[model samples]
Target: MNSTHDTSRHIGVHIDRPVQEVYAYTSDPTNLPAWARGLAGAVEKVGDQWVATASALGRVVVSFAPPNEFGVLDHDVTLPSGVTIYNPLRVIADGTGSEVVFTLRRQPEMTDAEFERDAGAVADDLARLRDLLESEG
Candidate 1:
C-alpha cells in the first residue's frame, strides 16, 4: 500500500477542456484505445468486464472504478498470465481546463529499462489524450 516503497512513474497532460468533459470521455473504458496506443488494437466488453487485445500483452481484462462525480478514473488490467496491474488515473480541475494524470507502476519482474519504457508509453498516451480533447474544443 506504500507507493513510496514501490517503483512508479507519474505522467500527466493538460487538456484544454473542463474537468467534467474530460472525465466523461476518459472514464469510459471503451475510449481507452483512442489514446492508449498499447490498447489501441482492440477493446470490447464481455458481460460486465472489459477485454482489450493489446499488441504487446495480447488479451487482458480491464476494470475501472465505478461511476462517480469525483473524476477518479482508476483502472486495473489483468494480463493473460494472471498478473494484474493497477493504474491510478485522475482528472482534476485546473482553472478552466483539466489535467489528466496516470500513474504507471513498475512490475516486480520488470527491469529499469522496461519501467522507463512503460512510463514513456504513458506519457505518449496522455499527450494523445490532450491533443484529442483540445482539438475537439
Candidate 2:
C-alpha cells in the first residue's frame, strides 16, 4: 500500500539529547516497547526480520530503513493479516537536543475519530520517548 496517498498526522517531541543518541536508540526496534506502548509490547529478531508483539496488532514484522548519517528512522510494519504500513520517522538536531518526528497514517477504512485517536496515541508515545530519554540524562 502507498502511504503517501493516505491521510497522515505528524507528531513530534523534543528530547534533551543529541540527535545521534536519540536516533541510535529510536531506530532500534528492540527499544519500541520502552516508549511506544501503543505499538509494541516486545520486539525480537527472528532470522532477518524483526518481529514485535504489538499491543494493537499482535505479532508483526518490522523493517527499518538502513542506517545513515541523516537520522532517518523510517520503517515498514507488516501485520499478520498481510497488510503493510509505511511509517516515516526522523530525528533531527536542535541545538544540543534533538527532535523526533513520527508520521502516523490513517488506514483507508478508519473513521475521523479513529484517526484523531491514533494521532493522539502517537503524540503520547513521543512524549513517553522524550520523558524516557530526558530522565536518563
Candidate 3:
C-alpha cells in the first residue's frame, strides 16, 4: 500500500438517546464545540459557510449535507491549505438508544502517527458526544 494514499477509520459510540435526538444535536454545527474538542471550541457562519474559528487545522470552512430523515450527517472541512476533507457520519437507531458513527479519513499527506492521532481525536469526540447525550436525555 502506498503511504501517500488515503484511508479511513470508523470510530463510533452508543448513546442512550434516540436516533432522532442524536441526529438533531450533532447535525447542528453550533453544538460541535460542546462535544468535538478538535474544533478548538468556536464556530460561526460566514455568510453561507460554517467556519470554525480555531482548530488543530487552523480556521476551516465546514459544509454539511442537507438534513434528511435517514440520519446522514456527512460534511466537508476545508483546511487552511485549501485541502478539503470529507467526513462521513451517521446516527442509527439501536432499539431505544442510538449509535453514532464517525468516519475519520486519513489524508494522503499524513504520517502513520498523525493518522493515529486523528483517529484518537475522533474517538474522544464520539465519547464526549455519548456522555453529553446520554446524560442530558
Candidate 4:
C-alpha cells in the first residue's frame, strides 16, 4: 500500500471477561483514560461530548455511539485542527471471554512510519484493556 491512499488495519485483543461487561466499561467515555492512551491521560465532559484538553494531537473532542446491542463502541475524535476521525471498535463474544477489535484507519497523508506507530498504539491500548479486564476475574 502507498502513502497516498487510506488504509484500514484491525487491531484486537482477547479479554477474559463477558462481552456485555466489556462493552459496558469500554463504552463509557470516562473510562478511556485508564486504557486508551492514544486518546489522552484524562478526559472531561463538555456538554454531551468528552474533551481531552491535552493530547498528542492537542485538545480534541470525542463523541461515542449510543448504547447498542451489537457490541459496537464506535466513536469520533475531532482533533484540534477540526478533522474528525472515525474509530470503529467492537467487543464480541469469545466463549466466556470477549474479543475487542479496533479498526485503525490511516489517513491519506500519513506516512508508513506514522501508520505503523498508530497501529502499534492501538495494539498497546488493546493489550492494556485486556490486562485490566482479565485481572478483575
The alpha-carbon deviation from the true structure for residue 17 of candidate 4, after best TM-score superposition, in angstroms, is: 0.5
Using TM-score as the measure, the top candidate is 4
lDDT of 3 by residue, 1-137 (tens): 22654477788898999899999999999998899888647989889999886656789999999999999999988889998988899999999999999988877767888888888888998999999988896
lDDT of 3 at 106: 74
Q: After superposition, which runs of candidate 3 have C-alpha atoms over 4 Å from their true positions?
A: 1-6
lDDT of 4: 0.89
For model 2, what is the alpha-carbon lDDT of residue 84? 96
In candidate 2, what are the lDDT values of residues 7-42, reduced to their tens digit? 877898889999989998898888999998887889
Q: Write the per-residue lDDT of candidate 4 for residues 12-95, one digit (tens) a residue.
A: 999989999999999988888899988878899988779975467778998889999999999998988889999999999999
Question: TM-score for each prediction?
Answer: 0.93, 0.92, 0.92, 0.94
Q: Is candidate 3 or candidate 4 better by lDDT?
A: 4
Better of 2 and 3 by lDDT: 2
Give the Cα-based TM-score of candidate 3 against the true structure.
Answer: 0.92
Clashing pairs in 3: none
Q: Find the number of clashing residue pairs for candidate 3.
A: 0
Every candidate's lDDT: 0.87, 0.88, 0.87, 0.89
lDDT accuracy of residue 51 in candidate 1: 93
lDDT of candidate 2 at residue 49, scale 0 to 100: 95
